[model samples]
Target: MLIKTIFAGFGGQGVLSMGYVLAYAAMVEGLQVTYLPSYGAEVRGGTANCTVAISNEEIASPIASAPDNVVVMNNPSLEKFQHQILTGGVMFINTNLVESRPVRGDIVLYEIPCNDLAHDLGSDQSANMVMLGGFIEKTGLVKMESVRSAIGDVFKEKKKAKEMNLKALDVGFDYMRNNGGKA
Candidate 1:
């Protein structure tokens, strides 16, 4: 099956990293994947968004006008892209930062307390990964092992950033395992 996901938020929320991690996880699962990020200009106003496509076959388009899944990390991002998701799609909203309700009741809405959870895990910056963990767990689009490795792969060269990122991933994964995507 093909899965299209879009993650959008303001700058410094790890929006691009979320898409990168998801795509890398799909690749580790031996699937075809494409990750496209929109930045530079969009970040001028503090918006950052990215599209990730994963499929069993070749993905012709890297862009998703209506994604099957969406991760929104801010109120503006949520309000801007909530309507762009397809009916019956799954959405992960950062409840800590965004208190407003989503537009679609038909779709599955996960009000994830990402910021709070990340802070509890010792870093307020890891909220995006926490939200992603819940989404990944619910969708099962990627394997846990693959997700872990992907986090390492992204941060290995950075040295100083590796521990923090992997720890964040684990915290997010552990939260999902414990909470089962609720609360």
Candidate 2:
């Protein structure tokens, strides 16, 4: 199956890292994968976007002109990429940041209150992992274990963040499992 996903948000929200994790997870699964990232000039105040394509066969494109899924961590990202979601694709929105309705009804939608959840979990920094969890559960792009492995790989040198990242992902998964992609 072809799995194309885009992670977009403000520069420091970990969009590129999230893309790498997904791409790495796909590679670990022995699937074809590609990762591409674009960042605007203002650094933290600017936008950041990354695309990942995964397939069992050769991937025709890595550009994701129309993505099968999108994990949006900010309102601007939602406004910008919401139109690009393919029919039946899944969109994971961070409810803590975005309050707008999804632009496309043809695709599945998952809302996550990443910031609040992260804060409740003791740090506001784990929002990215929470959003990652929502993406995995809603799309089933890869197993959560694979995602967990990816987390290990991505945070290889950042020992302090490892546990929090894992916990955030689990929180996201549990929340989605309990909420069933609603609200």
Candidate 3:
């Protein structure tokens, strides 16, 4: 099995972190994974995105010409990557920040209010985790336990951050599960 996903948003929205955590989780599951991140020179507030490819077999390339999944956290990202999703693929949108919707009908779409959910969880920084959780729940590409473990590994030095992120993840997962998985 193979899945290529692109996470895109403003640099401070944790777009790279989302892809990193997913790649780490895939690694923990013993899957072959590749994560490639790109961002504007301005860093925060600038455009940032990452491509993650997870596969059971050897991957030939790190680049995703047509990603199987696209998680867009902002309107600009949605506009940029919406057309890049493979037909029948999935698109996860952060409804709180992105008001525009994709025009494509071939790909499945999930609208998640990530920032709102994270704010409710007490930390707006955890918005990415919320989106990640919903994506995981909808796709089931990797085990939840693996993601939790990866999160722990990524934030090993910050106990409070780890706890809050984990909670945000759970909230996203539950939100997707309860919302019937598609928009």
Best candidate, lDDT-wise? 3
What does candidate 2's lDDT look like per residue over 1-183, in tens digits? 888889999988878887888788888888899999999997786999999999999887789889988888888999998888888888888888888878567887788898988999996888888888877887778888898898898899998798899999999888888888675
Off by over 4 Å in 1: 40-45
**Candidates sorted by lDDT, descending order?**
3, 2, 1
* Residue 61 miss distance in model 2 (angstroms): 1.7
Number of clashes in every candidate structure?
Answer: 0, 0, 0
Residue range 1-183, candidate 1, lDDT tens digits? 778999998888888998898899888889999999987565445789999999999899999988999888888988888889999998887877887878667788766688888888788778878877787778889987898889889887976566776777667677777866653
Report lDDT (CA) for all predictions: 0.83, 0.86, 0.95
| Whole-structure CA lDDT of model 2 | 0.86
lDDT per residue for candidate 3 within 1-183, as digits (tens), equals 889999999989999999999999999999999999999998589999999999999998999989999999999999999888999999999999999999998999998999999999989899999999999999998999999999999999999999999999999999999986578
The residue pairs that clash in candidate 3, if any, are none
Off by over 4 Å in 2: none
User: How does candidate 3 score on lDDT?
Assistant: 0.95
Give me the candidate number with maximum TM-score: 3
